[model samples]
Target: MVVKRRFRQVFTSLKEHSRVSYAKIATIGGFCDLDLIVVKATSPDDLPLPDRYVHELLKIFSVSASSFRAFSLSFTRRFGKTHCWRVALKCLVLLHRLLRSLPDDSPFRSEILWTRSNGLLSLYPCHFLDDSSSASEDYTMFIRSYARLLDEVLDCLSIESKEAEEDEVLESLPDKMKEVGRMLEVLPQLQSIIDRVMDCRPTGASTRSFLVQSATKHIIRDSFICYTTFRKEIVMILDNLFQIPYRSSIAAFGIYKKAALQANQLSEFYDWCKFAGLCGSYEYPFIDRIPQIQVYALENFLNGMWQLTESSSSPASLLTSTMESPLSSTEDDSDKQLVIWEKVEENAFPRKLVKDEEEEPLLQWDVVDNGNWEDLLEASIGPCKASRNNLFYHSNGYGNNMGEYGQGEEANGWQMQLYNPYASNPFYQPQT
Candidate 1:
């Protein structure tokens, strides 16, 4: 009796503490004999939640105080919480894509530029977090910093090699040398921030605004400028050295990657990475190895080009010459052949949220409409000519139900106007 009484008291304690409970609302398709019951369940699958909900749950858990907690966005059959591990995956996928842009022999040839850009687009639906309370505030800061890091890292990568001295000088701060482990930890949070910033309601509009905002933000923009300049410098150096700029040169020149490996920026690195995990709620390991793979592809592309330069004959035209190719008249060796384009088609990663079969892809929305504005207007028109108002009103069977009387003096005396047999619309012509 005592235990039962206690249970009842706790169940009635919503007055003292915020309570969570299940409710069975009205049935879907209720008019039919068979109804679909809409019940709010304890599971995350309640209400077919969008992916953004998961980001909030995972990010809050990153703060020290909230680390043990977990929240989830649900689907009826499957579900997951947004966690730190997602940050790791986001970095890994992006880095992998960036590196793949370099070719095998070129050392900087990337094969997945298109693929990676697509992945970036796929990273949306992660912004609905509201972790302002002290319980989850640290995680929010971590995310903000992680976004700033990505903005800077990309900047360093873009810089030309001629300003290497200046770039190095500017990068002297301890935070500039963070390690790969640290970077991995924060990727998800960065992913969350970016993912959220890029997409809002009405879909495509937010991405443009977000990009513009990022470009204008001083810290983020400066970072891009630094890397872009650094990349330009390396390209110039390589162009002078071997009459070629292999992928390896540009990939190896990153400030963050170099500093991290050197152990000088490990503290800064760890801080950012940890913060990223806190924001994204996931850790990604794959980011660390992507550069190596990209380097290999670039190396192969450059070697192939160099080998051609070494043995090619001035006697034959460059276009017709198959002599420098791995496939040869004299040899049947497979490794000698350069598989430039079609070699990796089957291995590409699948993206999230492909559109429906009949739907046209997202493009600009300023196009001509066939007709019908009155049907689209849900609100009342302040004042328009009676004829215009009559268009929609007369089309409806219960036109008078709209708070305006259609009978008596409101109906102008123009009803006796004779119909023209030669009118444009044949339906309006008088009967023969």
Candidate 2:
């Protein structure tokens, strides 16, 4: 009972501090302080910690988990949206570190806890963008920090000895492979977040907008490049595994095959984005847009392994086509042209109209005599026919001719003032 009360007090203190002090929430002094208390209590009794007491401590950590969850959800809410962005990101960073700090023997060392914690962290950008108050600087910083965390995690999981014998390396490969797969699952989410952040505008006008925009573009481009690098490293590790005797290499080959397939898919998606113009020139380049040569070579090597294992024509046919086709041929020039044309059409009219009006007319074709055209059209057509969807028209069809000229004693004298060809049309309109 005393232990329960003590844990309650500790939970309350940690919860209170998590809200205000970013530094304190991140340190061992925060929740880990409570962990020490629980550990010490068991020592004084000279007995193994009661399962009930340990459960109570888990419950306390659960509260910290809930706090992080609440912080993430609060980002989209109207109240404190601006202030919550930094707080929530900080909490996630701290929680990620805290989870990593748990002893190997701790109950929380399981995959479930890590997944729950990392899943919340992965959703940071989805909520971050939902908040209207988030600044570009916040997004830039969040992305950089998230990337750093991933790098650290990967660095920890990476195998050091490149020349180690297959048996020696295979012992550690399973755990390392699982970690890589888990981290790979998070890449798509990170890419999606970076894409959305790039699409977001700064909340208000500021001199930093250009810099923020540039920084975000670079971050996204660099992140994708980093993902490709990590994939290459994984493939190289798999290749080392394949160098062993055929009997031992079979299981490793299976993992390698799957990784190769996924790498192909990721590369294709990146290419689609680049060709579709979703990516900008500020970061994405025309030549060597996606680093897929390594992916292609890895894929071919896996396909050869599959041919050997299954005695199948499928892998042979796939390899033949892959070798025959140029990477650019995958996305047809006609489709690329169509996509470019569609974008041009969408931005062509109003933007062109605005620019033309600002500059002095240089050619006969450049000058548009809207006033005279309207006068001629009005003389030809009497009054605009009323339609149900027309805002100016009424159900009884009486207000179809309503305009500045139709309002007063001038109504009878006004000759249904110059019928505006653009008025009835929704697409084109001359700016007032």
Candidate 3:
């Protein structure tokens, strides 16, 4: 009974601090080879291996395991609709659930807890963007935490400790970790799936307004350059496992092979112009605009993934705000959805640098080589272009005048769902 109560408190502490700590690692951790970023509060020498931190780490591990487990189990079946974005969401929810589980003999429950603003600005982009070292930290913390949790749970259940032992705990970590790596590798698949689904819906040419030829180019760039980075991280994680010898590596070996096959599909994006049907002549370079809506979606999806890896010390406010509301918009009455693309020729960001304001503008990036999609990824992050991803035009929170557009969630249910993950205003109060 004592253990359970203390563990409850211990977990609560973990939940609170882990939120900020995890974010730190996710953002800054990537720069340093994906190792776990242990943001020491006060000094590490002062705290040592405290009980509260142990319990919290345990919970974070269990949460990461359970979430990825679901993705692994679901992948051979139904992961496409939202696998790219959906898998990350499922992981965060599972992380929250795992932090709450506890056992009675919580030895380190009374350890000192701490927090600070330094936790932020670490810029943990998200798990997908984080590299092998940061990913390894997530793996290591998860294993250590799981070992402790498993031991405690067995004791509480009155099951023979011998029934479930140390080696078993250690063995479980690699499989769970590798599974997560595999799932994340497939994150880029979101674009292809979205494309296929939208394409399945017919478009009546008559109802279509302003069919932009450049949208295809934008999608291609996003698919290859942006999505490939995600896919590459997944491969890096899986490949890194080969360095660590474990039984789980055997299980992951097959998964790695499958991930490899999925990776092959990405090559098709190199010829995105062919698939998006953007081969026709254009007045401007059509393939370089930032797909702001899609990128925004990727950012939110990554944010949730990092939350799942965290130790659970964050408040709901930070978490809630991280889940931004979508831009509000009205739905077009047309039942047909267009698998149309947005133009990159008129990108608004980085304000095209021009020495000679000549009528025939110079291609700034000078990317005439359109043979591979990887070249597109070489183009760094810049300003956002106008979005067709969400139709802010559908009267989301717009005034009587067409110029006054608002993306308030209350004004448009559709817009709210899309923006709920990336915007910062979901927690904002609605005007009466």
Candidate 4:
């Protein structure tokens, strides 16, 4: 068996050397040799492919996005056709390294993660079997499981890359529910990847290789990334539980159940890592179970909020606000909804219909006599102080004019009051 394995290695090395030599020749003739990239990527040597090849791949990607598909096809084809375990593992490592090297904002990451043609970026199409020896078969199984985990990692990176691109827009118009939905989408993928990492560990009493040890390092690194990201997203979801919206009581309950399950699973997974003596286990933070108090509080909050929505006259319209409100306005009447302020007060912060009328209020306030500066300051800040007394002060407080406007008549445009940050005031006040 030893003789046979040596002979196979010799033959593989010769074949690889021939390909590299031909690729060098192709390069000298001013030709782009993609096969060279694939050969280097799937090299049977235990060590990682050198930095030059990675740079070459990035250069190709820089030319055009479409050119990247060609590289993907070649890399996937090599992985699919190879019978050697070392070559297959090398393919996985090479792909993993490429993903790590790419920037989070790169468009290529999504393409690599989701490309479905010819099973690119997916291992489901692989059917590897090495029956020459038990050790070889063990390596094959490890490769398969590791490949599965890499698929999940790619999935996570893709989601994050897309999110980074849309970050500005999402921040400008923040949506807590939408953000939570995305976190929900990614959290499970991290869990699955960690599970696969566990499965990729060496089988009992199986003789390991330098290649296998190298693979172990990659697995450990990936597990760390997955574990840290998993914990962070879970904690964020829990911390912001009150802000995230739910469609119904069941949805909120579902999140609570998921959080609890993930907490338990994390504890178990960490314990298993400790038992297995996996590197970096000691560095992991202590797992804290989600407190039931939080769950109960969330339950109460959801109950009150949903109850208010149900009792509203236009429950369907509650999702939106009227055009008069600063909330988004839709031109379609069917999509429009009554804002709370409109229901409570008809003339609160009324917007001037004409631009000409809008300028009149500011002009009236600016032309106040410089002689009565104390009266002017009093007039500006006094009515606004009334706003701090009540949480929901919506009445138009301008029944008496302070400047040029006639007495006993309300101001024509919006009403604004001055605030002294130095003075004591309620923690929250209306802004308009």
**Candidate with best lDDT:** 4
- Give the per-residue lDDT of model 4 (tens digit) for 164-226: 777776675457655765776677666667667766776643324666666676677666666
Residue-level lDDT for 100 in candidate 4 = 83
Q: Assess candidate 3 and give its TM-score to the true structure.
A: 0.20
Error of 4 at 223 (Å): 2.3
Model 4's lDDT to the true fold?
Answer: 0.55
> What ranking emerges by lDDT with the best candidate at the front?
4, 2, 3, 1
Cα-based lDDT for every prediction: 0.27, 0.35, 0.30, 0.55
Q: How does candidate 2 fare on TM-score?
A: 0.27
Q: Please give the distance, in angstroms, between residue 321's alpha carbon in candidate 3 and its true position after superposition.
A: 54
TM of each candidate vs. truth: 0.19, 0.27, 0.20, 0.56
lDDT string for model 3 (1-432, tens) is 667655654554454355436645675656421122122211111122234433545555455644333322322121111112112222322222232333433322111000101221111222222111212233323323322322232222332233234436556556655444344434434333323322322123311212112222333333344344544455554444323322233333434344444444443433443544544433223233233332333333222212211122233333232333222212331221111111222321112212233212112211223322222222111222324243232222222332322333333332211122223434333223
- The positional error of residue 177 in candidate 3, measured at the CA in angstroms, is 7.2
lDDT of 1 by residue, 137-196 (tens): 333333334444443333323332223335456464334222221232233233333332
**Regions of candidate 4 where Cα sits further than 4 Å from its true position:** 1-32, 63-66, 117-121, 131-134, 157-174, 204-207, 246-432
lDDT for predicted candidate 1 compared with the true structure: 0.27
What's the ranking of the predictions by TM-score, best on top?
Answer: 4, 2, 3, 1
Residue 186's lDDT in candidate 4: 72
